[model samples]
Target: MALWGGRFSETPADAVFALSRSVHFDWRLAPYDLRSSLAHLAVLQSSGLLEDSVAEPIRGALNELISEVAAGRFVANETDEDVHSALERGLTEKLGAIGGSLRAGRSRNDQVATDLRLYAIDHMIEVAQQILALQSALIAKASEYGDAPAPGFTHLQHAQPVLFGHEIAKHVQGFSRDLDRIHDWLDRALVSPLGSGALAGSSLPLSPEVTAKNLGFTSSAANSIDGVSDRDFVAEALFTLSMVGIHLSRIGEEWCIWATTEFGWAKVADAYSTGSSIMPQKKNPDMAELARGKAGRLVGNLTGVLTMLKGLPFAYNRDLQEDKEPLFDSIDTVLLVLPAVTGMVATTDFDREKMALAAPLGFSLATEIADYLVQAKVPFAHAHEAAGKCVAMCEASGRQLHQLTDEEFASIHPSLKGDVRDVLTVHGALESRTTVGGTSPSSFKQQIKESTAITAAYSKEFTDKAKAFSEMMGA
Candidate 1:
């Protein structure tokens, strides 16, 4: 029975246990519970709520519990209600009332909230590493494929030639933004809620700052009711993870398309691809597909949390316990999936031959051809029309615009000269794009250098954050 049941006349129906039990999901927070106890016990002894003689045994036993839980020896029953009661039962069994005295200045309300927040703060840094690993894979692939031409598409139609590296590099920017969000969310989730007892501040003269210091929070909550009740920080982290997952999904979708037989320009590595059971010859990009599908799960988890909190009133609810399960699920899904994706990306093979062949098929150099006429003093609108007509001429007959003889070119546009063919050759078209941020080889190499520098800077940032988190955890 719960500690509070002594005041109730009747025990809750057995069915209430089924509805209210969160131990199965929240068991993952057992380590955080032990850490909380350590902090609260420290403050309790310092404030003389308990003598050091009492606090000493509680601290030692709590450390042992942490090891038990870490080693997979801890389990709680429905009667234990949750981790808090389970830990209390363990302490009471070991040290008599001294264990019970540690709960003096705290309530399960603020305690569980603090545990959830601490758990989130630790996990967010991990998820950020997975994001960084994905980013590293992308940067490596981008740098590897520097200036390897691929068809750039808009609205699913071939629009122009682009270095394959630049296409992959664009998503590096998106993931970097996701990294930003992960840190911002972690910053919010790190606020401490330990001293908000029940629906009010503790009657004991507890110092929240001391507890926050012990648990690695920069500060403690300002309002007692809000501290225990508000889970917006958790929701914020989930929402950010959802966005990162979505971005991965979008990248996965592109890889799926690229790996298909219809578009053989990109090949999945053997480790990342799986063979169909019935079709021995098939090499499907299963990891990519799963990453895409898991995005929906993360998005759904975010929605589940948001829906749970939408209309609820302030302060804690049984519904708030619903938060941890979805978060754990989403984090587990992504962290497990991202490393595989990083491997897939790191090992992907770029089909330079197929990309080069496909590069010229859609009259991809039409804009450059237009610029050719524009440089010859033709008005751009007129130049655009003339380029369209040239495209139509190639489509009507079976000859490319570049294949037209000087006599053939003069028929389409009198301003066109024989040397226009020199300007339209594949090498010429790729070379003449000398504008900043253009597709020219020189421009892409410059872009690759700049992107490489950014990747190095981001690597240093993530590495430092990881070090700081390690130091804070005393790991």
Candidate 2:
């Protein structure tokens, strides 16, 4: 049953139908479409378009249809153009004539817009929860590796001594902001477009607020044209998902490098890793590599959607049909990625001995020597030059800065007096960074505590929001 063919004497050509069909990718929106239909049904009855006698049976049938779809007993058929068409076809079959009235005050334009919003909200909650799960794993890793000194890099070369946990916390901070962006995106996505019938709304006295409230939206769209047309929510969702992909990619890149034989800093678990086909010695971080690779796909999804939206006029367009596959693919990709990476992080073993051994290489503690000289009332330029000379002398003699004798230090600089080597140790270097958010043990522990609180707080907030939304949608 085609949704619109009364004006045409002939049926759409098979090629036309083939080009127009979206049921393959869009059938997933059936549940949201049905929920929106039920809400619209109530609004119709309340406005006297559908009498209670007709409305109640339609309601029962819609609910029954929802159950059937959930049980996989009802599904989009080959003839159905999209999820909305398939579900409407189901409803009309049940009610004979009354099911057709449910479309009285809504269009596929607004209907699809609302359904997409609902779908995005539901999955965004899931995605946000998964992000928090990854954050928790990282937090646990940070706590477990607390104050273990490692080489912190600039240009991928050792630049300073830092606690390994602090480096993990840096990733946590990025994910934390991703969580914040999700929260912000939800605020803009919560408005309903259900009542904006085909862009200009209806002549009937239908109340958009009634459907909006029933569907868990904070409010109805203010402008009827904008309601059916606005896909900013979808764009924002894509961007947020892309950021998540980028972050996961960073983790993947780091783990890939860390698991290398040359780095020897970490090892991915056997379950999360793969062996080579031809070579028996390979324990490849394939999942990490995939996560890195999928970031490009997620980014492409965003770019594709934006390009599709860029030149379109206001209100609904056929181009909007291009939005869902990319959006859906990105969501699926991120959902698939978060847990695998989290599991990898949770199960991986870090070689603390190797990391610590590398922590002081490449004169990473030269800054400490400069700071030490400044504490003795020497000019900073003189102190900096003295530290550089110390590094040069150590390099010349094939020794570490800490390996230099006191006489060797004195010859390098007049201020290289007694116990200058005291600041040369890794622990000393780490401990000396005692400011807030520093790599010192005390500061690292505090950072872990703060991150734990943040995850807990966001988890509760999103969980509560999801619960309320599900209840409002009668899910």
Query: What lDDT tens digits, residue by residue, belong to model 1 across residues 21-74?
Result: 777788878888888888888888888888877878888888888787778776
Number of the top-ranking candidate, with TM-score as the measure? 2
lDDT on C-alpha atoms for all candidate structures: 0.82, 0.92
- Stretches of candidate 2 above 4 Å error? 379-382
TM per model? 0.93, 0.97
Residue 288 lDDT in model 1?
87
RMSD to the true structure for each prediction, in A, is: 2.2, 1.4
For residues 185-223, what per-residue lDDT tens digits would candidate 2 score against the true structure?
A: 998999999889999989998999988988988999999
lDDT of 1 at 53: 79
The per-residue C-alpha lDDT of model 2 at residue 439 equals: 94
**TM-score result, candidate 2:** 0.97
